[model samples]
Target: MQFNPVTFAIPVFVALIVAELLWARRRQPRAYESRDTATSLAIGLGSTVAGGLTAAAVLAMLVWAHSATPLSIGWAWWAWPLCFVLDDLAYYTFHRSAHRVRWFWASHVNHHSSQHYNLSTALRQSWTGFFAASFIFRLPLAFAGFEPGMILACGGFNLIYQFWIHTESIKRMPHWFEAVMNTPSHHRVHHAVNARYLDRNYAGTFIIWDKLFGTFAAEDDADQIRYGIVHQIGSFNPLKVVFHEWLAIARDVWRAPWRHKLSYLWREPGWSHDGSRETSDMIRRRWNAAATDQKD
Candidate 1:
């Protein structure tokens, strides 16, 4: 059986969420909305169930891939840390692709749907990740000789490390820690719908990956951060939150010309056949241009 640290951390996750709720009450009431929290929890539960159903198949594939490879890193103590760091890098790659590629983004967008950023919002996971083939990202580790179980355990720890950072409770960490790790401040920029912050800070555990890869964007206190997608679904319905993007993709593909149909599935989010919509990059360009004009 694949060892998943997230399974053991469920109780701790609950306690921390409750503590965050109380803190929100005393500090930031808007941080926790009733319906939004319920929807996020419901989606998270479904995502867990979805992942459970697919876990065995994913592990089996990883094992098969590992068997095909001649290299074996084995279960050495050093392998554990090495596997974790590599797994985090894999997450960074998957995450960056998930934003840049619409098919992957459809599965990832649910995690960013909530307008609120709190511990509970961290629970907002995607139910269709398996359908989107996100597990493909970790397959490289299997091919590289890391054991499938070790890769999973490391990925679980990565998830756990990310949970607390999805909040407004703590503004920033120590300068050194913030520079090295993915903190609330950095992650907030990731989740923000602000044009300046769009498609940035995709680090899973270590902020170093984003820093190295040039995807890092620091949080600016002067500009208020608005959470959620560019086109807000404007609903608390969990099913809508989970399937809206997929449905949109289907509709866009069906309606587009045959030559452009596949583009709808693979192109960046907000791409349009007729230049009718704006992707994050387009939005950022416009914002920058307007700012430059105003300064002139």
Candidate 2:
């Protein structure tokens, strides 16, 4: 039997979420809404269902790729650490692409749809992520001779590490930890829809990737972080939240001219055929300009 770390972590995840819920009720009742929490849990259930349905095929592909590859970097003691780092790098690449590319963003947008930042919000995952082929990002590890099981285990640990960061309950961490790891503070900035925070802090387990790639932005105390996507979804219905962006993408691509259809699918979330929509870069520039004007 294959060991599934995420499945084993489910009880721990539930316990922590319950603890957070109790903490929020006592300290910050406004941090969570009943409907939003239910929606998040529903979406999470759907993601697990979708993931299980696709697991066989995904594993098959990885196995085939691993067999075909010439190199066999076996399960040495050091290989585990190496796999963890490489898998995290793969996550950073896929995650950044999910934000930048519309097709992937259609699946990913649901994860960011919740306005409330809580432990439940981490469970609000994408039902269509399997279809989005985001797993392809980690395929290189398999082809490079890393065992698929090791890669998957590292990926699970990466996700488990991220779950705690979704909460607003914990504030900043120690300076050394904050500097090196993806703490709650850094992740809050990532989830913020604020123009300045948009598309920044794309890290998985380590903060070093964001700093090295010029995507790191410190959380600002002056500007409050607003959670959710740029255009918020009004409904708490899981179905609507899961497929809204996909529907929007379909609509945009259907109406777009032939020459621009590919761009509509591949470009950033806010990109449009005309200059009417604003990408994250454009939004940030406008925000910066307005700030400059205010100072002047």
Candidate 3:
């Protein structure tokens, strides 16, 4: 077993969740729904098992890729920060694709299934990420000469950084900090199902990626945020929460015409061959148009 920061942070993660639970009881009772919290924790546990099962193969591939590289970052201290930033960029790419691309979204949707925004929602990780081949997103760093272990460690820290931002408890960070880093405010926008927020704020550690890529949507204090997917999966059952999107994708692929079959797999969620459903772009357009009409 390698030195995974996430594993070491597990105790602290539990402590914070307990602290948040106590806070929620007094400040916002609705923030901690018992069933939702349990489901999220179970899914998170299953994800760890799933990741453990596939870690060896994934690490072997990264090691091979790194060995083949002409350049080697080797164990330089300066390399850690560079690797961490690059890894975060890779995460931003993966996180954005996990929303824009249905195949990836099928694996990532469980994280956003909970309607409540709390520490527990952070634990709703994906059990199918390895199967989704999400590790490919970070393979570029390995090929670019960073050690596989360093890349994985940086990724662990990135995951840890994101866990605390998954709450409604913190409204906003300072303006300067909010501008650069991924805060609870920025993350809340990412989790929001609102028309304006859909497919926005994909940064994992730094918010700069979203700003640079035009995917940034600030958390609007005036407009109440609604969490979860556009089409709600109204079940707290861990199995349903984790696999519903995947099952839907399978059903869609099976039912679609041969010509459009692949589209169902790769297209953004809500995409239908006959235009029966709406993608985020389509939903946003509709919402914008309605807003325009009401103003007129």
Error of 3 at 222 (Å): 1.1
lDDT of 2 by residue, 1-296 (tens): 44568888889999998999999999999888999999999998999899888877777778888999998998998999999998999999999999999999998999999999999999988789888888899899999999988888888899999999998888889999999999999999999999999999889999899999999999998999999999889999999999998899889889999999999889998998789999999999999999999999
lDDT string for model 1 (1-296, tens) is: 67889989989999999999998899899999999999988988998999899999899989998999998999999999999999999999999999999999999999999998999999988898889999999999999999988988899999999999988989889999998999999999999999999999999999999989899999999999999999998999999999999999999999999999999989999999999999999999999999899999
Q: Which segments of model 1 are wrong by more than 4 Å?
A: none
TM per prediction: 0.99, 0.98, 0.99
Order of candidate numbers by lDDT, starting with the best? 1, 3, 2
Ranking under TM-score, best-scoring first? 1, 3, 2
lDDT of 1: 0.93
| Runs off by more than 4 Å, candidate 2 | none
Q: What value of lDDT does candidate 3 attain over all alpha carbons?
A: 0.92
TM-score of 1: 0.99
> Which should have the higher lDDT, number 1 or number 2?
1
Native-to-model Cα distance after best TM-score fit, residue 219 in candidate 2, in Å:
0.7
- How many clashes show up in model 1? 0
Top-lDDT structure, candidate number: 1
lDDT-wise, the better of 1 and 3 is 1
